[model samples]
Target: MKRHTAREKAFQLLFQMDLNEFDPNEELHEHHGEEEIDSFLETLVQGVVQQQTTIDENISYHLENWSIRRIASVEKTILRIATYEILYMEDIPTNVSINEAVELASKYGDEKSGKFVNGVLSKIIA
Candidate 1:
């Protein structure tokens, strides 16, 4: 059987986070084992979880009055993952990270989520 890629796993893990609203590490354990996730994705997930406050702070900084919580859970998750990738995962290009996050937001968020994600990430990139 085909397994979920790191990115796919990250999406689901992030989704679980929205529902659970707990520590990402615990949420990760409930949803995926070490073998179920890849090294890169695991690193990304852990990094995001660890630096969430800072990452979110940066996002919130760029959001003006829009808090991260006010944003849709899917959009928040995509942003968290993408922000982690762009800020920490130096191996990945900034555009690739933002584009992937925007794509995920488009699929999992509301109709305008793509634009929202793009706008926020573009601000970070700028």
Candidate 2:
């Protein structure tokens, strides 16, 4: 799968996991059906899960007045995914991650979410 597609799927899986508190394996199986799971997708979901504390800390540090918990769900998910890529996935460029995160936010979040994501990620990158 393309990285874009993988990222979106990872975001969806993460969102579901947060809402249902289900095991990642079960969430993947339930949402994905028989489709072949992309390795990149697996890496993203697992990476975010594995490094969530650090990622959330980074987010918290960068957020102006917003706690990580106070952010909207979709925006938080996008931020976590991008933050994982920025901090852990060395193969992806920082700009690419930020840009994709903004796109995801614009698509899935409120009107201001893209700007909010960009601001937080830019802070993290800086």
Candidate 3:
């Protein structure tokens, strides 16, 4: 089985929350056919949700003239995923995290969202 992209999975969970007020933790079982999620991605998703305040802080610190609350839902989700990967998963290269984040933003976020994710992550990595 192909593993679902973390952002893609997160997108579904977040969308469900937005529309139905369901808990994200409980909603994850509704997996669509996709790549098998590795342990790393599972950790990333959980870490992001568990340490959202720290992730939001990292984003706020790196994002000039932007607040975490003001970011779009898609962009925010990508940021949280990538930030968690960056901070918690040492095995995944920094470049891969940044690239995945950019891809996620492009697919789910607005036109400007990819650039924003890239910029903030670059700062965090540097």
Candidate 4:
């Protein structure tokens, strides 16, 4: 799968994991069924899972006058994914991570989500 597509699927899986509290491996198998799992997708989901506390801490630190808890789950999840990429994924450029995250927020989150994500990620990379 293309990185874009893998990222999208990873977002969906992570979103579900956030909402449902399911294990990533089980959820991923259920998600793909007979299809082979995408390596990038697996890497993203697992990386986010392993590093979530650090990612959330980073995101929370970047927020201005906002508690991480107050953020909507969609925005929070998007932020987590982007933050993970920025901090952990050396191969992907920070700009690419931010742009892709903004796109995901624009597509899946509320009206303000894209800007909110961009703002927070900009702070993260700054």
User: Best lDDT goes to which candidate?
Assistant: 4
Models 1 onward score TM values of: 0.84, 0.95, 0.80, 0.96
* Clash totals for all candidate models: 0, 0, 6, 0
lDDT for each residue of candidate 2 in 56-104, tens digit (9 for 90 to 100) = 9999999897888889889999999999999998989999999999999
Q: How would you encode candidate 1's per-residue C-alpha lDDT over 47-126 as one tens digit per residue?
A: 87789899999889888679888987788878888888888878889998887887777777889999999999999989
Please report how far candidate 1 places residue 32 from its true position, in Å.
4.9
lDDT of 1 at 7: 71
Tell me the spans in candidate 2 whose CA falls farther than 4 Å from its real position: none
* Candidates in descending lDDT order: 4, 2, 1, 3
Global fold similarity of model 3 (TM-score): 0.80
lDDT values for all models = 0.79, 0.91, 0.73, 0.92
Error of 1 at 67 (Å): 1.4
Model 4 scores what on Cα lDDT? 0.92
Q: Distance from true position, residue 64, model 1, in Å?
A: 3.3
Which model is ahead, 3 or 4, in terms of TM-score? 4
Ranking by TM-score: 4, 2, 1, 3
Which residue pairs in candidate 3 collide? 2-34, 2-35, 2-36, 3-35, 3-36, 4-35
How far off is residue 126 in model 2, in Å?
0.1
State the displacement of the C-alpha of residue 91, model 1, in Å, after optimal TM-score superposition. Answer: 1.1
Worst 10-residue lDDT window for candidate 4 reads 10-19
